[model samples]
Target: MICSSSSSSSRLGWRGAVVVVAALVACRHGQRPMPAPFKLAVFPVQNASGGTAPIRPLTEALDAALGARGLEVVPRGNLDAVLAQHRMRFTGGVDRPMAKVLREELGVDAMLVPTLEQHVADAPPKIAMGVRLVGTGERPVVLWADAVARSGNDAPGLLARGLVTSSGELDRTVVAEVARRVEAYVSKGAAGDSCGDAGRFQPRRVFRAPVLDDVGRRSIAVLPFINDTPRRSASDVILGQFVAQLARSGSFEVLDPGFVREELLGHRIVLEGGVSVDNAMALLSLLNADLVLSGYVRQYVGGQGAPRVEFTAYVLDRRTQELVWSSSSLGEGNDGVFFFGAGRVHTASALSCRMVRGVVDHIVGRRGPLGPAD
Candidate 1:
């Protein structure tokens, strides 16, 4: 009996026992359920400031800020590795394939795409940025979006006591506000109040709507605007503003531009001059969107002086490719600032957002007449 027992114990020695225990522990850990199905992946900050600005620092700060908010964020290294593996560098929006990759491969639920539109190192630094959260599902949709066009001096209190001097400091401040909004939507599923036609930043004229009011809750695709302005990628900056506004309106499930871009590429579609009816129809069939929003960015410039943004936007029905709404909008930073610089915008990105929101509001019939801080 002793000989038989000794042989059995030798076969399953201490090392085997330890290995069995470790395997059981790992299995237990693997069985533990995840708190939620949603995990956020933040894309690297895109530098659309048209100048050299610190991108890495802002990206790291934003990632850290989101993590501090208790949201599960996929590590930056992991997302970047995936991006490199797939060679996915488009920042306009998350294409469907990229979304699938992030969702299945990396387990990323949503995406936060931030673009620095304008930045200037003045006495009081001015920065304008647009942040958007796009849900990574079958249809990539913008869940929550916000834009900040701010100059430190825009809010200086008595005796210039509250001036923001450093761009880095201002970056964190703006980013924190945005992160708070993102976390709110993530935890409570409620975004901040929409700022539609609230400020002096409004389109000068919004006219001629045939089928605009009827297109509620419909899916819309905003194509890239023609960058006629000298500012590099001005069209992209304004397109982002429209995307942010349209998403914020809660009136339409604005398709992610990256997804739209991917479709356009696959179909070999081109917008030579502007989106023709044929182009719109092709996009309509491909994207299954109710409307297509296309535009031309004539002037989008901001610097030492008042920022100015001018553009024309038109929406066409997907089935008929008939014009639904076509309007031209133009605004300046000091459009209605009458007081001692009380309500003035400092960056083109913010100004464009304001102008675009006004147009979106008018289309949805939610805005009041042109005014200041309504």
Candidate 2:
């Protein structure tokens, strides 16, 4: 009897040990591993400072900074070639749809969109820059963003003198600061409220009218916008941005602008004063489109330090010859700082992009004005 009891005790101990080992292994496997460093594609830095300044040095400086931070950056030449192959102009901005294309084509995990806020070669050499790191997926995310503003006199005499002589030094300093902020954001894994506050610098205005149920599935044609601003090219800039936003929404089948232009020319129909019912019907028949989008650039003013944009849009049903939807947006650029005279300026392109985004969002049934802190 004693021998049998001892054997039973030994077997129970072995069973308990096995259970404990299994539990330990399961625990180890349950923990998620840290993600690998992102394979990043740094797009060409957009020049939004309203000047003819060369942006090559700035782009190189940013690449070097990110490389030092252990990021694998796509080479500039390769990026440029891809852009050319796709017939894409580097507009210093990439909407969600474009980002998806870049991800699939370039095999990049994320894209870096940087804008030159201020790049002056004046005596004190002012420079400001903003950068956004966007993740690529079906739903794009703004993973990180930070802006840097600096004046030559902000640094010591030796450094300030170097900035005056070589803009490369200034670029490096700004890029380094941006890299530092981005690193901190990644390590924390949360942007917190402070990052949310940074969005206050730009505000968005959105308006929406009732849209037809089938608008989402219809093919759309964007006519040439009427240019009311002094700048002859303002209409072209706004039109390109508007089309890009509409395409990004994925709510409509946007027809090719070149095709639309050619068809309009063939019909001898100039949409200068808006589309007449008969003209609209004829054009729709020629293009076999479902809807027509027309807009007028009410305000597109850009100067040394201030840029503003305003536009109104209308959506007409091709079959009914009735206006189905209307939306308008207004935006102004401002440097985020006001107290110490250390603010960053916004460019005309940036303002127009914001306004177009607002209009698109409203048309897609997302009706709400973006707050300052959005």
Candidate 3:
């Protein structure tokens, strides 16, 4: 997940030129008062410094915010397939020139091209972004563009002490700016008639637990999360919160750490150090678990009366060793400063909880029967 920027390219031409002209003309003629809601796609932001950018979180946040504003967002996976088909290589941020190409190639109403200004993981990770909206030939105008920056401590201590941790506001700031632009574009008639045709402008919802039906209960093993952060205690802090939340959900019969360790010991699985995928599988089998969950706490800070935590998780299928569901979350608190930033102003517990829950629901609930309520 190195944060790298794509090499700059010459000004767009051919298809890019055509799209630009059509877009500007539509704006001038005012053929339609308002364009239809749009189908939007986002490419991952690149990090020039080889640092991991908050790619998924910021993208998800933008999707959620835009969805609230009545725009449709195509799923990232699907968007990737479309882009790959067109043989486009997206290196992190989307510059203006790249946006036009993506929009035309993908046949989408708009493409979000972001330029990565900063992607260092320092004490306060620096994750800055510049965004531009590129439209198709029917809507060539570059509807909007914006840039956002955030600084924080505990980024990840990369490339000397220069790259600290990621800032709490980094992802939020990018999402807000993108949301504002999307809203403005729709209001200014850049959206066009696409939205009117529901089939074209609809987001494909990843079905989670649509319903509870003749479901078979599956046991899950929640393994210890690796501490990828610079802080020594960061892993423990995030671990506590994760286990607590999973326990609260009561979705699966959770195997406590003690139980897992004991099982590992009996099977001579070497529990003295970090757990690998094979070790995790052995433990799962011994515990009679169906799935194994593991992740790493990428950043954590709690020295100056304020605490921050950032972590990621993955649900692995024991048999196939495939990552069925994976996600990342960051939580911060001014008052609670420690203990995983519980109950603080900057805490993302509610939102993070929803995200983790969504992953769980997707994995387990999907296997369950779809209910009428869902």
- Top of the candidates by TM-score: 1
Candidate 3 has what TM-score? 0.35
| Runs of candidate 1 exceeding 4 Å displacement | 1-37, 193-198, 215-217, 366-374
TM-score of each: 0.84, 0.47, 0.35
Candidate 1 structure quality by residue, lDDT tens digits, 145-222 = 777667888778888899889887888887787778777766644546434364666666566555565543267899
Q: How far is candidate 1 from the true structure (C-alpha RMSD, Å)?
A: 13.9
Q: Residues 255-291, candidate 2, lDDT per residue (tens digit)?
A: 5454566567666887767667677778778767778
Give lDDT: candidate 1, residue 24: 42
TM-score of 2: 0.47
Ranking by lDDT: 1, 2, 3
Whole-model Cα lDDT of every candidate shown, in order: 0.74, 0.58, 0.47
Say which prediction, candidate 1 or candidate 3, comes out ahead on lDDT. 1
Model 1 collision count: 0
Residue 313 lDDT in model 3?
70
